[model samples]
Target: MVRKAKELNLKNNEDFALWKNFLENVGINNFSEEEVNQVDLTIGIFDKQKLLATGSLAGNILKYIAVSADSIGTGSNFNLIVSELIGKLALKGIFHTFVFTKPKYVTSFQHLGFKKLAVTEFGAVLERGFPDISTYLADIKQTENPVKKTAAIVMNANPFTLGHKFLVEQASQENDLVYVFVVATNAGLFATDERLKLVKQGTQHLSNVKVVSGGSYMVSYATFPAYFLDSPNDLIEYQTTLDALVFKNWIANYLHINTRYLGSEPLSRTTSIYNKILKKVLTPEISVKIINRRQLLNGEVISASNVRKKIAQNKLNELNELVPETTLKFIRENAAILKLRIKKGMKIRGN
Candidate 1:
């Protein structure tokens, strides 16, 4: 009989070793510190002393899932693991959940009510529960007024720099309507609400631009955890391809978004790769526009990363040229809080 799934203590050395070895045995490697550090909880099915199957929850997204192939009982192990994970999430008032898994196992998750949002050759993104992609799109449609040409831009906007403003200004000028989807992930130095507020304030003058949260469908932990994690190139390619396809298939298709505007990535290898994949997957159906990076008078490219470094180093005077007055004011007011976060080891170097 299959044992009931129990929470596995990843902090325990023995448990961590068993979990890592089990995942490796099932062909799931790449246990980088950034990836492993994101897991909030892990659950496993064990038959007496032997492990049968295991899965993990990292925020709202599932990760590090594996099952022993030779387990004796019925094929209920996968379902049990998923059900347990969902149950744990529900306890935390998180009814919506997502999973990134192999293409072959997409049907397995579908059996348990996970809808496939996007699928690539390397991986698939699936989500289960309330306020799914359909609901998100419906809400967006309710707020929008139809137009002849529609464009979209997805941005993390860690602190909303002038470069981001320039990109939005360009798209707003070119299209009848522009949707600025601020990435909803709260992993950045600036919280999600702060980032959204900054974007709205910075672009308030542009009447055609609609600043909205990207929800869990954009470059979120659900669709692209690699954006936050230090991931390998192959892993980055897979995650980015899935992220781009989701935009093309769901967001772009439902909202009639015909163009996606992206800033040229002269820094951040991860973002450079993501831009390339967005072009590869979003074109032909949706036009991809790459705007050159906005630069300062000194010829230095304006980026949120550089702005964040200035904040960390207490170089507020240098930020006036990099960010708009609105963002500069926010930084000045929240300088202490922002520096506290950095002192507490918040990563300011990534996208």
Candidate 2:
């Protein structure tokens, strides 16, 4: 008989070694600090001092799940690990959860109530529980007329710069209604709520534009964790592909979004790759409009990265040319705190 699942203290060297070896044996080799540090809790099933199965929870996301193949009741052990994780999440009042697993394990998770949101050749994204994709879509306020031209834009606007404002303005001019889905992941210089607020304030004059949180449905930590982690190209490809497909299959379909807008990425390799994958997956079904990135008269492209760099360097005077007044005001008011975050090792670089 298998022992009841118990919390594994990864801080302990012995427990860490067991968990690491178990995951590596199961073909999960990526144990980078960026990824491991996100885990909030880890649970393992053991039998007579041998680890039989293990799983982890990171802010409602299930990861690092592994079950011993030679162990008796392997399927039962897998279910037990997942059930423990879900029970823990429920205790935190988190009903919605998500997981990214191998394509072969898709059906296994499905049997545990996880519905596949998107599946690529390399990996798959699944979700389980209330306030799900359906709830996310249903909660969004739709336009008065369903037939009107509608466009969608997903942005991580770390601090909403003028370039983002330009993209929204262009979409507002061309489409009757525009949905600006701010990337909901909070692993950035600015918090998720700050980014969303800055974007809304920056574009408040646009009558047709509505700014909303992307939630865990689009470009979230669950769907595209690579966006925040220092991941390899293939990993980025798998995550970006799944993220795009979720937009195409669920978000666009439900909202009647006919077009998706993106600013051309010339600086960030990750975002450029994401843009290409978005076009590859979302085009033909949903029109893709790639607007040239807004630039200043000095030939420097306005970007949130540049704005962040300015903050890091204590160069407030340089930001007026990059961000709108609203964003600039926020940064000026919070410059000390922003600099403190950078001093404390908040990455100022990257998306």
Candidate 3:
């Protein structure tokens, strides 16, 4: 009686408790309460009579993959659920995929078209045809010898779109290597890992780029506010500056990045303001380059808000035009689930 459905409402504490136990039983203990809530509702799987397993499609990686202890090795349920999830995301047109798997389940993932990456202290990073994120970025840090030009492209993927591709391509041309860091905070529509994977898939062909999660200490999804309150613009500006300072300082110390690139969009209220303030405030140590905003097929500027509006209207065609082909396909395949995401929160439509 195992079946896949896209509209199951499982937000209650009871449901979360069920998933919490299931995930811990599988050895993934560091994930938080907020993290589990970011699952795109549509990708959640139900067994014949109970919620037994679940996963979410993020960037090029399939994340939060878990199965109930009672359901482990029970028939082909695990295989079936994961296959369906991947199939859904694949239809969104993403070519390469990634997932974190238990050491014992490495073979199972390989059979499912994923190649295991060397284990990190955190977890096993796996991918298929996607560049190894760790080595993807070109060495751009300038030393006494003038290290190659390197740029850190930071984002809260919130589901990467075609606009992201344009920005990356623009930055990659000027730098030897582009480090794409997906903000690993629980503050937005998608969890940190999911957003990172989406960004990875959207930008995989760019040879000089690497994608990785911005760890908690540097940029917190938990502490950062995706939506500003009715507070004054200066306060918002102050907060933005503080966060930017924190992010830049960490990248310099940890990743050796010295240059940063951002998109310049005149229409985004928050970003436009942040840009104006940041240009003056960012330390003199790192170079800041802002690419002009990218445009949509209609010749108007494309934005995350616009893409979301199209998705909310079920206008898949328009959404696809705004996102990369892979991103468009991913959204369409998960359309049913994605549609439900609209109802989740007041501040973050998808997070």
Best prediction by TM-score = 2
Which structure is stronger by lDDT: 2 or 3? 2
The 0-to-1 C-alpha lDDT of every candidate, in the order given, reads 0.86, 0.87, 0.62
The alpha-carbon deviation from the true structure for residue 297 of candidate 1, after best TM-score superposition, in angstroms, is: 2.5
* Per-residue error (Å), model 1, residue 83: 1.9
Q: After superposition, how far is residue 124 of candidate 2 from its true place, in Å?
A: 0.5
lDDT of 1 by residue, 1-351 (tens): 648677899999999999988888877677777778889999999887788999899989888777788876536887788888999999999999988777888998899999999888777889999989999989877345567789999999999999999999999999988999999878889999999999999999999889999987875533354422223546777877888888899999888999999999977777887788889898888999999997777888899999999999889999999999999999999999999999999999977
Candidate 2 lDDT by residue in tens digits, 221-329: 3334442222365777787888888889999998999999999999877788888988999879899999999778889989888899999988899999999999999
Please report how far candidate 2 places residue 278 from its true position, in Å: 0.8
By TM-score, the candidates rank as 2, 1, 3
TM-score of 2: 0.92
Which ten contiguous residues of candidate 1 have the minimum total lDDT? 221-230
Cα TM-score of candidate 3: 0.53
In model 3, the runs with Cα more than 4 Å from the true position are 1-146, 217-234, 345-351
